[model samples]
Target: MGDGPVTRETTKSAADDIRVDQWAGGVRRITITRPTLRNAYRSQTAVEIAAAIEQFTADDADQVLVITGAGGAFCAGGDLTSSYESTHADAVQLGHGVVIREGMHRVMRALALCDKPVIAMISGPAVAGGLALALACDLRIGDDTARLGDTSGMVGLLPDEGGAWLFPRAMGTDHALRMLWGCELYDAQQALELGLLTQVVPAAELESAVLALATRITRTAPLTTRVVKRMVRNAMSQSLHASLIEAEYAVAAINDTADVREGIAAFLDKRTPRFVGR
Candidate 1:
């Protein structure tokens, strides 16, 4: 969570490369603004995105996060052919993987630590590190024009930004390896079949669909949502017995919250429950 100053601004800010905005239904949206190169992010762009994610993680009022790109495209990944050396010259010395460690790695770390749910709103191409970024999120909603793939080998760079670990898990090891080796790109429907996307809508309806999804999530119990995100992600690697034990612990902590009482009372009364994040 971010320890820096965080405020709930009523308006959206787009002065920087990454636009951060807090919307109704307690949703925070982060948009990469470099749409010319299909939103191919540089080091500064990664830093800004990481900061936005951390801020969302820290803010109490924000219930869900929506990450997307401006224009028609999603992120095209990091610019491998750019002047990365000049950008990193001021920060750290050149060494084994120092560039990514200081740049996009911060984003991966932030995403991993975030207890809140993240939704990747993918529109156009989301390849390479961009694909990894989307995979890190709890859910991915894409449009029909959406594209996903790995082009790391073509540029002689590995998916150093969490793709190496996330790709194999999203779509089995064999399929992930096949796509990686072939530098394959898939359309939204194909990505959905491969388990990369949760849902795919038409380009025109993408915004409304994503907004509806976020609003639906915001109506859920906030504390339960965060805990469920963590527990489910951890359960992927945990045994059934261990997961049960973890669930017991979670229940123990959550049963005492005022929201639980509100939920039970609302159920008996046949009314909507008002949760205050207690």
Candidate 2:
């Protein structure tokens, strides 16, 4: 990844509903472009988002992925018109559940399991499934205008796409319960205090802040970064003993990389190391 923006083959689905931009320093930005809908995604849009994330993970040049929305709002959640009402009349009772489980849930799972670091850049509301999507990322940066919460309760729905699991893990069981039960929406500062946001900046500074963080991450050795991401995510579910065992394997693997040698040499030589992601 160079310092300049790089061109890559853009997928048709991504071009239409999602937009993928590869910036220098191994950062790939995936933007949800349905601004008129406040970035609300239908089932098909969720599939396109999953596809873009899959591409980012497989692209060797990409080390960090930043997910955001165009026209201010991050995401308003699933497109109810396309997902529920239109299909509800024609679909069996279970069909609605099936559609969500196979569609948006898969997108959330992809974000959660991505080996590379994923960051959510939230400039506006991240409601319901949209909040779940943001929670799936490894880190979240929000702007002052940002508002986040689970809005499903208002509509007599549950946070079906990993919100129940992710919210509790991120903000503890009690806080998660309150938010879900009350449909409590928090402003950017409140979200930061609740540990929902990694950092919050003025609206105008959000992009620069996200870019600075991404740049810092890309300067590290790629192999180590990926390994660390995997290890930490695994630790969330794995027992301490199992996590240690996995870390042992990861350490051995990373120790063998040329980047490790360069890191050691750089320390001894008292100079900044240039990593080629070897």
Candidate 3:
């Protein structure tokens, strides 16, 4: 799939609270629009996010997916007040657990299963389930003003929405355990040092930095890019020998693409190659 403009028929419905924007260079930006509650994920919001992610993966024109929050904050977490039940006092503990499993878990899984590259654009606080959402992305670009943490322990709760699994994988088990247990928050610089963020920029330059990186990624052949994402994700669980075999097969498939020939020819000619993602 090649990068191009999105058509009306391919566009998703606007009824979802999340804002979906497909840019010219294959970047699909999904913005959480709720800022008053710090963009917390209600059951409906989680469903919308899951749907947007699925649409992004299915759209050939969308090569990269960027998940961001509107206003100053990224997300506060799951909106405890926005449950389907009439009131929190009337809701059973089992019902609350089911909501987390069915709503937030689905959103996190969608991001994890996406074949294309996914980036989390964090400009402010990403706490609790919000932290889990950011961790699900393949890469994270955060502003210096951003804060990251898992505050579930503070409220006598567990990180049920992929946090227990994702946090340990991103930041080591020791660091993840400390954060979860102490309910500590890390500044953007600390997050970068701890490997939670791929890069940190000034708040004013966050969008530019993210766009630049996405543009660079979109310059590569689409098939190669998608294959690399899948292979690396699989490598986390696969044995080294198995990963090597997978890489060999991936290389063979990529070699058969027209973009490979163009890439080589352009290199020999000392010119910028134009890849159509063939």
Candidate 4:
């Protein structure tokens, strides 16, 4: 959808190598394009992902975001082949080496902190760090072929990059521990059963399913949607009373937005409101 002439501001840059294309209507798609490595996040790719997500958050043109992979594989894990070798076993050697960089941590944090509602469209294997990235989104829609799990333990490392925190809340603590410690892989139905995926569809329907969800979400008042999302996030770390107060303030803030006035006017006129995401 970003098919127009590339201006200095709109031209793709090195820091935004992770492709982010904005659809003019109100949706943005961020695709992890390194399919040759099963879309694994390494130093540069992770940084690019964070930068792209930051760009999406700053853009008022879109109200919904869909994150997906570019090819058959969604993501495998960290780029272990590049990160380690038998000779680099010792901490001293590993610390001095640039191979095992920690750029993915910044990427994970950016995904979690972005205010836009993110939908993960998983079409293939999304294991280890990939699953962690999917879980950070507001919703996950996976194809029947998709696999979700943390494979960190299999590679002799504990789960990092928000996996340890998100899984405990998403699935129960016991389920999270079982998946982590046992290194069990979960298919689409298993993931849905465990509350990991919001919906599971055939591979051909995966992208359409996520877009449908995005469409419905965009039909709501954007300001209120963000406010409710923020309040729910605050409730995770704050007291119930505090969360209620936060929600109250958020509602007050959304009341000042143009979308709210348009919504009211449309309802009075018995017509659909065209929210500008203002």
Question: On residues 190-244, what C-alpha lDDT tens digit does candidate 3 reach at each position?
Answer: 9998888899989988887887788788888888899999999999999999999
* Candidate 1 C-alpha lDDT tens digits along 30-144: 9888888899888788888898889889988889898999998889998755636334654424542666876789999999999998999999999998999999998999999
Cα lDDT, all candidates: 0.86, 0.86, 0.85, 0.77
**How would you encode candidate 2's per-residue C-alpha lDDT over 156-275 as one tens digit per residue?**
788888898899998999999999999999999999999899999888888878888898999899988988988988898999999999989998898988999999999999999888
Error at 148, model 2, angstroms: 0.3
The residue pairs in collision within model 4 are none
TM-scores of all candidate predictions against the true structure? 0.91, 0.93, 0.91, 0.88
Residue 264 in model 3: lDDT: 95
Q: In model 2, what are the clashing residue pairs, if there are any?
A: none
Alpha-carbon shift of residue 39 in model 2 (angstroms): 0.5
lDDT of 2 at 158: 82
Q: Which 10 successive residues of model 2 have the least lDDT summed?
A: 1-10
Shift in Å, residue 160, candidate 3: 0.6
Candidate 2 displacement at residue 36 in angstroms: 1.0
